[model samples]
Target: MINLPMSAPTFIKSAEIYRSLRKKGITIRKTIDCLIAVLCLEHEVRLFRNDHDFLFIAEHFPLRIV
Candidate 1:
């Protein structure tokens, strides 16, 4: 188990990601998913998720989805 910190910059980045997705006509069902995606992106870690929303986020960001 690991504890990932969410700082002000991370939260700002998450909101930017959400806004970017929205601009592309993609609507993420949950805000937490955006936060998680930002964390993975910041840490350079691949995210393993079954949620379809991630596909959209992955497309816009450099998020590695496995």
Candidate 2:
């Protein structure tokens, strides 16, 4: 079961985004980066991250990582 605060809707969206990226052959080495990207994409939030993985994610997805 998903955490109720962020339930099925959010989980489904995150999973879908992740799957789509994977299907497109976008390889994100870090799972945390993928998770953060999905959350930011879904919520339209900026991510101030120094990890290069986040930069990779931003290139492929609509995530703003600093």
Candidate 3:
């Protein structure tokens, strides 16, 4: 549970999310943020962040952020 693995499907899912969000005009500034968002989406992990970007992302994508 310490080291999170980034496999092929993970990256693929990330790309998919990026494209979907992009199409919706939800521009995420950082690639890492997109990756992390995808990771949480896929794993059902709740994210605790105070960043506005994450709030915007959560609005479009289903994420439990606090």
Return the top candidate by lDDT.
Answer: 1
- lDDT-based ranking: 1, 3, 2
Write down the lDDT of every candidate, Cα atoms only: 0.91, 0.68, 0.78
Instruction: Give the top-scoring candidate (TM-score).
Output: 1
Clashing pairs in 1: none
Q: Rank by TM-score, highest first.
A: 1, 3, 2
Off by over 4 Å in 2: 1-5
Which digits, one per residue and each the tens of the lDDT, describe model 3 over residues 1-66? Answer: 434567889888777777878898888777677778777877788888867777877887787788
Clash count in backbone of candidate 1:
0
**TM of each candidate vs. truth:** 0.93, 0.62, 0.79
Q: Which stretches of candidate 1 lie over 4 Å from their true place?
A: none
- Per-residue accuracy of model 1 over 1-66 as CA lDDT, tens digit each: 557888999999999999989988899999889999999988888899999989999888889999
lDDT of 1 at 31: 86
Candidate 2's residue-wise lDDT over 1-28, tens digit each?
2222455676676666667778888766
